[model samples]
Target: MDDAQPITTLSGQIVQMGHLDGSLIERMRHEALTAPAPWKAEYGEFQSGGWWTTSLMNASGDAADVRIADGSARPTTLLQHMPATAGLLACLGLNYMWVRLARLEANAFLWEHRDYDELEQAERHRLHIPLQTNTSAFLVTGGTKVHMDGGRIWRLTPTYAHGVCNLLGPDRIHLIADVYTDDAYARLTKHAQEPTVDERLPTASEADLSEHLATARRLADLGYTAAAEQLLLRLFYSFAMPEGTAYDLIAGLHTALGDAEASKRWTAAKSTLLALAS
Candidate 1:
C-alpha cells in the first residue's frame, strides 16, 4: 500500500476499523457506569426479549426500549448505550435505526444475520447512509481472540456471515446501532467524523490490491494457467508481494509453467523484494 494514499475502496468509502485509544475508552466507561440515572430496562417492538437502559447514557437522544424477561413494560425506548449512543448521534449527523445494549457470557454467540435487506435497486441510486454500525461487547473482557479489548470496534456487515463466541468468564456488553447518514464531511474532517454507511468497505487503493489477489485465485481455480500467469505478472509490479516461504512457492509455480519470461519476472521481483527486506 502507498503510505500517502488514503486507504479506501474503489468507490471512495472510508474504512474505519480499529480500537479506540485506551484512555478514551476508559473515559467513556467511567462516564457511562458512573452516571446518576438508575439503570432501567426498556422494551422493543420487534425483538422478543430485547431491553435497554439509560443509567450509563449521556447522549442526546432518548434511551432504547427493551422487552425484559419479567415482562416489565411492553417496550420503551428509554435505556441507551452511553458512549456509542452519544457518539453516533453527535458526530455522524445520523438518525434512524435501533440501537441496543447487550450482555453475553462465556460460550455466548449471536446467530449471524444481516442488518437490513440489501438496498433496493431504486434506493441504491439514492444517497447512502450508515444504517448499521455496532461496537463489540463491553462487559465481556478477556479471550484468546484477535480483538479482545472491551473497547475494540469492528465494522461488520452481518450479511457476510459473522459470529462471535465468548470464551471468557465475564459477560460481554455491546452497544450496537442502526444508523443512516445525512451529510458528508470534508476529507480533512473525515477522520474526526462518525463512521459512514459504507465505512466497512476497503478503500479504493486497497481494493486494487484485494481485486488483483481475488482474480489470481479465481483464475488459478479455473485451470486457466496462462491467464493467471498474466495477471500475476501485473500484480508483481503493482504490489509489494508477500515474501519468504510464499515467494519460493510462487517462483516454483512460474518455473513449472516453462515460461522463462514469466519465471524471470517473478524471480526478479522476488529479488527486489528480498533486497528491500534486508
Candidate 2:
C-alpha cells in the first residue's frame, strides 16, 4: 500500500510483488515476438529511436495509441491474439487505465526522466512483466541499476527520475500496465519485496566527466550532432550524477562548440526531460 499515492516526485523504489507462470511467460513471449503488432514510435522526446510500444489496452481501443490517457480502457486488436497475456491481465483484476508492450531494441534508451506528469492526477502504479529481455537491458533509478528479471511482476514508481537501456540487447520487450489503485491492487502488491539486482551505480569523477565531454565535443565538431547528443544522454547509465546532469553536459557541449541555438535547445530539453520546475 506504499503505492497508494506517492508523496515524492521520484518513488525511487523497484519492488517485486507476486509472479507469473514460466510456461505462460514463454507463451506470451512467443505471441509478443511473432504477432503482427502495430508498434508505434512514441514518446520521441523521452527515448532513443529504437524504443517502440504497442497498446494491449487503451482508451481508443487501438493498438497504435501508445500514449497514456484517462479512460475506461479496453483491449486493443493486438491483445486479441495474445491469449496468454490477456488471460494473465484478466486474472490480475486491477482497475485498468492502459497496457502496452514496450520493446526496447539493441543500443536503445529511455533517458533519465519522470512519468505520469502529463496525465490527470490519480492514484495509480505501473507493473512490468518482462517477457523477453537480455542481461544488458536494465533500468536505472535512485542512482542504482535494477534488472527486473522474468517470471515476476515488477512495480516501479516511475514518477521518479529514471532511465532504461538495452545496451547490447537483441531486444527487451515488457508488458507494462498502468492501473488505478483498488482492492485488487492491494492483493497483487501485498507481498512486495526488494528487487534482486539492485546495484548502486558507479560514480564518474571530474576527470572521467571531462574526458567524456571532450569525446562529445569531438563528435559534435565532426558533425555528428545527433551522436554527440546521444553520447551525453547515455552518461546517465555510465555514472551517478544528479538528475539532469547529462542534459546540462549536452548544453555545455553545444555551447563549447559555438552553437548557441543548440545549447539553448539542450537547456530546454533538460527542463522538459526531467520535468523540472521552471
Candidate 3:
C-alpha cells in the first residue's frame, strides 16, 4: 500500500466527477429529506449549529464512527432505505470506506479546518455528490469559492484547510463518499478537470489582521468566548495563513484575557489538530 501524502501536496483540491443521472439524484435527495433517522450535529468546537450528518456506509456500520480510514465498508439501515442510492453506489464500483449524507441548514457554517489528519496514512479521497443545494451553499478552498452544482460528482481534498457555508438556504444536502484510491477511482478521475476559481479571497493586510484581533478582544471581553474564537477561526478562510495560525490566534486571545489555562489548552490543541502522523 502506498503511504498517504500530505494534503497540502495534492495537485488540486477540487475535481469534476463527470455527469450523473439527474432523476436518480432527485430520488436520493427526496429520500434523504424525508428520512426520519436522527441527524447527528457536528462537533460544537468545529461548527455552528444546523449542520448534521447520517451515515450510509461506514466502518463497523456504525453511524457514530465518522472518522476516515481503511475499513470494511458496510451499508447502514439508512442505505437500505435508499435503494436507488445503493444502486447508484453499486454502479460506480468504487471502493467506498465511509459514506454519509451531510445537511447544512440555512445560515450554517463549517469553520475552516482540515480533515483526514487523524486517519492512518493511506491513499484515499473524499467525493461529494450534491443532491439538494443552492447558490448560497458553497465551499471555500485555496482562497477560491466553488459552488458544486448537481448533476456531477465533485472531489474535495480535505487535507487542506477549507470551509463550507450555507449562507442562505432552505437546506442543503450532499451525498458524500470517502473512497480508497484504486483503479476505478483513477479511471473515474482520468478526465478530472480543475475547478474554476469562482472568487479569490484577497490577502489580509496587517491592518486587517489588527482590526480582527481587536474585535475578537472586544467580543471576548463581552463574555462571548465562543464567538470570539469563531471570529478568529473565520480568518483562515479569508487569508492564506501558515498552518495552525487560527489556533495560535485563539491561544493568544486566551492569554491576553488572563486565562493562562485556556491559553495552554488551545496551544496544545493546535498541535494535536494539525499533526499528520502515519
Taking all chains together, each candidate's TM-score versus the true structure is 0.36, 0.94, 0.88
lDDT of 1: 0.36
Report the lDDT tens digits of candidate 3 across residue range 1-278.
11322123225888776889889999988888886656887565567788888888987776655545678698887777788889999988999989988999998888766788767788999999999999988887766778888999999998877778888897989999999999999988988887653666666666777798899999999999989988888786667555666777888889989999999987776655554342
lDDT at position 6, candidate 1: 27
Candidate 3, run of 10 with poorest lDDT: 1-10
Error of 3 at 102 (Å): 1.0
lDDT, each prediction: 0.36, 0.87, 0.79
Pairs that clash in candidate 3: none
- The segments of candidate 2 whose C-alpha lies over 4 angstroms from its true place after superposition are 1-12
With candidate 2 superimposed using the best TM-score fit, by how many Å does residue 97's alpha carbon deviate from the native?
0.6
* Model 1 C-alpha lDDT per residue in residues 1-278, reported as the tens digit of each score: 22443212312221244345566555555544454433444322111122224422223333433221111121123333245445643554434344444444454343211223333222111112222123332111010112224444433332222224344435444454433343432321344322343212223345665566467657766888656644544332223322222234345565655557765765665444333332
Best-first order by lDDT: 2, 3, 1
Residue 9 displacement in candidate 2 (angstroms): 15
